[model samples]
Target chain A: MLRIEDLRVEIGGKAVLQNVNLHIPAGETHILFGPNGSGKTSLMLTIMGYSNYKVTRGRITFKGEDITYLPIHERARLGIGVSFQRPPTINGLSLRKMVEICSSDREANVDHLAEQVNLSSFLERDVNANLSGGEIKRSELLQLSAQQPDLVLLDEPESGVDLENIALLGESINALLNRGVKRSGSDVHKGMMQKRSKSALVITHTGHILDYITADRGQVLNNGVMQCSQNAREILKWIREYGYQECMTCTN
Target chain B: MYKLDSNGEVNPKDFSTEAESHDYIEDLAQIDGSDTAEFENVGVETDDSNRSATFILKDLSVVHCKSKQEGIEVLKITEAMDKYDWLKDYMWKDISPEKDIYTQQASESPGEGFFIRAEKGVVSKRPVQTCLHISKEGFAQNVHNIVIVEEGAELHVIAGCSTARHAERGLHIGVSEFYVKKGATLKYTMVHDWGEKIFVRPRTVTHVDEGGVYISNYISMKPVGSLQMNPITYLDGKDSIARFNSVLVAAGGTDMDTGSVVVLGAENARAEIISRAITTGGNIIARGSIIGNVPGVRGHLECKGLILNDGLLHAIPELEAHAPNVEMSHEAAVGKIDQREIEYLMARGLDEDEAISTIVRGFLNVDIEGLPPSLVRKLDRVIADTQDDMM
Candidate 1:
């Protein structure tokens, strides 16, 4: 559903992302692996179309449309959603109000999703403010759960939360996928909604996210450069046994 | 119309005399460093011969003083007179002795007068903001203001007054009169800040016609020795509404006596007054009174004070309802800043200054929605400057 080819970006007179290419086909989930200062967050921010990130040479296509120059809110309007690693604390704006503002379909079951992500109690609080780091993560997942987007971006969604909450995050993502299918109960048994695809590109520092959801593909990024793609499970096993340092010999 | 006589009081020049008026104009023209007038084309003149009111009456002796410690008494009177001259003709001629600056300042000459007149059905969207600064010591300022929002007209006025240095005695006597016509709306905001040794007495009154709305927001941030302000609005119109919201902060040897009185005289008239004061190093006495005279009139008064120092703060609220259908209520409180609230903000990584400024700004801020952009910008600056000293 989303494709990036040779994404070269410059920020503050420094190269943050250079010659990076990745593709997530329909119904596929991909994991982006990188260490600190490894351009992982930069790639996410670039994909989100934040200003000040100069895309010198790149082509980002989503749903067969070139959205490289699209504004952030416009891209969001076009069924693109993101969960920031460290979300901002919006003081006066309530969480429920922000969710309603960002979502397209008002008929979506918000209360059930809030209950599923453990954010039912924090529905009245200002967005992400006064919330514990773990609570903030769950709130992010809850907001994401309500958004039936064609493509989703998650940045370190499992960094600060507990294991159980992390599993809940996985379940919420699954629920989001199920909702995006738009199939009735009787038709679901017949796989009538199989034609619909839910795509996502997630960034993870640790392989713990692999424990929650099945990622179809994996790519390692270093200093704004991406290596060859491989199977997610094999890459997970490789990283677990050795580490990202194992790729030092293959610098090319 | 009543007139104040000169008995042991500094006398204003006989402006009723044409020769004296001519000479005064010539002197002001020379002092303003122009042959004619500075803002001659900006406003309307009383007559075709006289210039539009822009010249602020500033005395020569006070302006030439170089010493900073002469005390603010002299400069205060001069500054107040300057504003009075700018507003006089637009206001009424008769003022009570208690509201007269000539009686208060026997030695210093009074300031200018400000008068505003809006014809019927005039809707003014631009807010008028005036700033008065007392730079020298021994300053005495007497300013008089009169505003008339005619039928169906609207206006907003913002005033900021301050002294240059701390610990100087400045004297200020200001009188303001507002007349709101039927279906008109008027909003007024006044901020008072003066150096030490300053004594201020301000008297204000307003009369609302039928179907008129009046909103007054007063803030006292800096008061030197003693500051007394009495603001009143009389609602004589049916279906009229009046509200007074005041925020006062008295610190460091300051003494503030601020009060607001609202009287509902017509049927279905409504009035509300909210007064807040925060004292750190001095004493503050804030009082609010609401009187419902006609049947079916409604009024409420609320006064709150926060005492930061062991300094004394008293809040007295009173309500009077004569008619059976009228409703009146009053509430008053005296306390300190809530520590838990400050601690909560501090826990959010904001410094002490940031948290305090935020709290103060929020406390003083009201819904200024629908106000002009220019006025909002000026109010933001006023908040910033006042927050700087406390935080």
Candidate 2:
């Protein structure tokens, strides 16, 4: 559902992602593996149409529409959501208020959504203000859930979360992508079958999130270049056996 | 006559004739408005306004409102003193003993104001709503208010002050003294809405006795020429609590200087002062001070300012502790709104302006706990109205 063609992005006149091409078909979840400063965030931001990214050569198409020149809010209106690795703390905006702003349904069950991530107590608290690592992740997930975006971009959701919360975060991500096990009867599932499939591009550093999310494809990004595209588990095994340095010699 | 210096010290002004003070009062009386319609927006009942709460208009015109509740009396200061000689002792007792600029201005030509008294063991369920409005140009409304909450009594007061639209230069000086007796609780909320040429000076003082609770919420979001005020509260008895919350928005050449001082004078007394100031193309100075003088006393002061566009904001917070067992702390911050916060809100489907308005509203939202639901709703409406003006 999303396509990036010859994307060359720069930040502060320095190229961060060069000649990168990525494509994720409908209903497909792609896993991006990269080390620190490996342009993963740069690619995500470029896809999200941040002006500071300076897309010198890029044509991003989402749902067959050119969104490369779209503003951040316009892209959000077009069903795009992201969870930052280290989101900035908003001093006075409450978590529940942010959810109300993000929700497509004016009367969305924010309490239920917050309950899913165990953030009911934080609903009244400031967004990300003095929140711990896991709590920030849960808060971001809560906002993403309210957004109900078709294309979700998660930046290292498993980075700071503990083991117990990570499971909850995984379940939230699954529910957000509409890939969770259907608890409603088969009749309700049949009615939802006609809906459009959800897509996501998850960025991970440790590959720990793969334990919960079933990624269809995996790609290795290193030094502002995409080297290999292969099976999600195979790439993880390759990286484990021989670090990212070996990806330079591998064929796609 | 006397004038208060910038350092809060009283200085004698040049002698003025009695005729000059009479002329001031005459000029004030020229601005007349019994409409009470303008106050409806602030959630104050105007139809039979006196039946609900005490009503005060411009100058010394209409102040004959009687409290419907037993053990609660709401009347003009002069009337209250004339009716009950005991109230004379509380009048002008907590404010500066020597006349300052505000006090002198108020005394020279006193305007219509309320004297609210909650008798001992009485709990006033309804808030005393006071509205002070100016409708004419070049007029000054000098008011003096006294509130006495007797022992074990509870009272809530909401004061709305505003001026007519497109009005010429005007001045408002209000001197308020509050006495919260032992085990009593008093919640006071003041909302100010002034025109472009209005100058406001409000001097307030409160004395909280043993186990009394005093909560103050001050908000001024409309445009004004200039404003300067420093309200002080003394926790004079053991276990007394005093909390002050202020939210102000200065826009379009308005100059506002607001501050609060909380003194913890007795053992185990606690005080907290929190202020939030937002300036858009204007100048604002937010100051807060908390003093812990007795053992086992705790005090905290927080002042935060948000500057938008070319506006200027200054935050000055001070903390003092005298006793070795006292704990005092203060934090002051002055900066522009965070771009990331705006962008974060924008990404949530809100346009830039909408995002900005939401953030501004959030910044102004000071959660005042323990307020009645009705008062909370009224306060929310006032805040929402002010935020609409901010946008």
Candidate 3:
């Protein structure tokens, strides 16, 4: 449901990302493995249309409509939702109101969504104000749940999260994507998997998220180049053995 | 107040302190058209059905004055003085008439102001509302007001001051004094909506006895030629509390110099002063000061201002502690809205303008701003009831 063709991006005259071609079809989740400062966030930010991450070349198309230079809110309205790694605190703007804002024209039961992430008591708190790492993750998921975007871009959901909360976060992510009762590699769940239409691009450096959620494809982005597209498990296993250096050398 | 000296102190002398008298009216309900609209703009309830009392003064005339609630008295200043031999002791008692030219003019002027008082143990079911209106061109209106809350009593006052639409280039000086007895609470809210060319000078003083509480909120949104006021309060008895909150906006050609001062004089007394201001193209000087005079007293001062356009915004917060065991602190911040905050809100599907307005509304602690007239009235009642519950 999303397409990026040779996307090159720059920030303040410095090239941060170059020649990144990727696609995530409907009902599929892709895992992006990258090391620190490897432009994984740059790609996500460029796709979200933040002004600072200037798309210098190539184009992005969502649902077959070009959105290379769309404004942030226009893109958000056009069904592109992103989870921020470190969102800013909005004083006096309560979380309940923020969730409503994210819901836009849709009918959002904010209390019900907040209850799913164990954020019911914090609905009155300011957005992202003094929230722990896990709470922030849950709050982001709650907002996304209200938004119900067709495609979700999650950036490092496992980072800074404790072992206990990561599992709950995985469950929340799965629920958000309508992916109940994981693939399990059995013929019985094939019908259930085909009914899922919400696609996602999940970013992770360590691939620890693979233990909880199922992914259809995986791609390695070393420096600013996209390496190879392969089966999700095979890439994770290879990266676990040889690290990102192998992906960088194999990119050429 | 008008000019500035080399010492950086404000000294006002540009306008004349003289106004012609107007005819007196017995019924304020007959007032309509733009005049009534102007009154509503400043939160004045001309229909006194929901108010404990209503008092209106036009130019130098006490047009209409009445009290409807039990244990409350509202009358013209001179009539009140004539009725109570002890009331003369309350007049000009805390706010000395010799302090400034405005106070001296108010003391000597023939204009009639209002006197409102709540008897002991009487809690007001509705706020006492009053308005000081200017309707003549180049008129200078001087008014002196007094408010008293007896022991174990609670009272709320809404005082609105505005010039009529046809009036031009006038001056308004309001001199007010307040007394809160032991075990009493007084909430005072003032709204100013003067015309574009009027000069406003308000001088106020307050005293709170033991176990008494004082809450004051001042708001000025429209444009004015120049305005300056600094009201001071003394928490003289043990365990007294005082709070001052003010919100102001200085548009193009408007100049505002407003502040509040609190003195915690007794043990265990507390005080807090908060002021928020915004300037689009005019100049704004927001000031707040808190002083702790005795051991175990505490005070805090916060002043924040935002400069939206090419104008001046100066914030001065002062804290003083005279005793070693007293605690006093102050915080002042003046700058423009953060760009990152704007984009953060914009990312949530709101256009740029909508995002900025939301942030601005939040910055002003927007409870009663930009609401429909009916909603404003409803919210006012809701807030009143909520405040009652909390108290």
Candidate 4:
């Protein structure tokens, strides 16, 4: 239930996403594959409504509603949530308190969510203060579990994530998708549901996310222009063999 | 008292009257008291023209009162040659001692009169300290002092008043004035610790020149009836500054009405006034005002009071700014000391009284100034004693 057509973005006078077109349907988890500076992170940042990236021309429709210019908070309220690459350190504010504030249900059980993401130890700590990289990742997951947003955006979740909790991350994501039945009557069951999933645009530069999650469609974005949107396995194989130079030449 | 000649040599000032001046000299010579050398020109007489101009401070030890009076026992000292010249004319001939007229009950007779003045371009780095101690009952002490720091000069003075346990119905009224010249700086500290049944009224006026700076620090403890103090400051010259830092405590049926005012009349002038009070079994009212009229001038006033043990604290702060470019802000609040902090400290192993003492010390330490390290250590001991008493 997501659509992108002719997406063109300019950042710092440099085009990062050009003429990009892709579609993610209900119940599918898609993995994006590209080399460094392939505009994968830029796409995620733009989708999350970060102001640093400018959209020159594009249309992004989620559930038949255009949300290209929506503010970050509004998008969040509309069930679009993002786990930042680097969380900010906000002093005098507790992590558990923020999770409670962000939860869709005011009476959401905080201890249960904290246990799900292995963030029970940081309940009293200031938000992101003195948190290890892995701890911060789990804390973000805890928030994600609490919110249970309709569309979840994750950036470099594998980075700095300890091996002990990576499986927990995958399980938490799966549980988040399986929760809170919308009016659509379609619920995720953690199988080959990627084909009919509501949609997830997972951004990855090294294609490492493919090992943990499945993908239905893949796109190769070089510099600012999309070379092609092809099968996820095919793009992974091509990049593993001939490298991104092939994508650059294809864009030229 | 040492005397300074025209050539600036050490000598002795003659204190005897004109009729007794020769007899005093003869007695000194016959007694072989070499240390009591007299000077003929000492104790210079003041002219009537100069008598009405300078501020006059009567020495506390030189007065006699036959009966109890409601008004100040005015002591006129126009015949003293060692008197400071700037204070010769501004002396008030009469001052009221009525309950409303006096800020507090006057106590303890003073010993000898004293005078101090600063010439232009002179600076004194060390603070001149004086201690007034009253140990007798129904004793009235009156003191008037004048200070004039000429242009480009700097001076610091610290005065303290304390009394014995038996001191009762004591009255003290003192007035002090400062004349600050261009580019001059003056810092004064007044500390009061009086016994029960003591009344004190103190008024001070400070005038600052262009580019001048004036600072006053006041500390009060155990005022019997009431200790009323009003410090008025005027900053007329550009780039001038005036600051008042005070801490007042009124306990055991005492009432204190103390405040300060600063007027910034020129561009680039600055004024800051801060006062903290702790009231326990007493009444305290603190009010401060800062008026800034010129552009680019800055003024700030903050008054805070703590009420504990059935005491009352009232604070009012007013700030006026006429120039758009000027920064002026005033805030006042009266409340009890936070109980949460005390509980936290207690949870950390400190007893309740120890915790309270720590909080009071921190609150009173709003001005950890340039006091000597030794003096600071002594003050720490004093704080420890206070905490022990509270506990």
Best by DockQ: 2
lDDT of 1 by residue, B20-107 (tens): 1112343332433221221121121112222112223222122221111111111223344465565444344334544455434422
Off by over 4 Å in 3: A181-196, A237-252, B1-28, B366-391
Output the worst ten-in-a-row residue range by lDDT, candidate 4 chain A.
A179-188
Q: Please list the C-alpha lDDT of all candidates, in the order they appear.
A: 0.64, 0.78, 0.82, 0.62
Report residue B215 deviation for candidate 1 (angstroms).
1.6
Each candidate's fnat, in order?
0.00, 0.60, 0.54, 0.00
Question: What lDDT tens digits, residue by residue, belong to model 3 across residues A1-252?
Answer: 899999999999999989999999988899998888999988998888887999899999998989999887777788888888888777667899889988988999899889878999999988899999889989888889888888899999998899998998998898788786655335367676566668899999999988888899999888888877988889999989998878878766
3 versus 4: better TM-score goes to:
3
TM-score of each: 0.50, 0.89, 0.89, 0.48
Regions of candidate 1 where Cα sits further than 4 Å from its true position: A1-252, B1-95, B98-111, B131-136, B164-167, B343-356, B368-391
Candidate 2 lDDT tens digits, A2-103: 998898888999999988889999888999998788899888878877667888897899989998888888888888889887777776778988888889
Question: What are the RMSD figures for all models against the true structure?
Answer: 16.4, 4.5, 5.5, 21.9
Per-residue C-alpha lDDT of model 2 across residues B1-391, encoded as one tens digit per residue: 2333467333212322111221222222233243344554343455433333555565335533546688888887777778988877777786763556657767766666788889999998677777776665666777778889999999888787877664566777788899999999999978787877667778888999999999998877767777888888999999999988988888777888889888899989998899888777788888888888878999888888887766888888988888788888888888877777777776777877777777777877787554444445655665565455555
Q: Report the error of model 2 at residue B322, Å.
A: 1.8
What DockQ does model 1 achieve?
Answer: 0.03
Candidate 4 on A149-173: residue-level lDDT in tens? 6676777677777777776676665
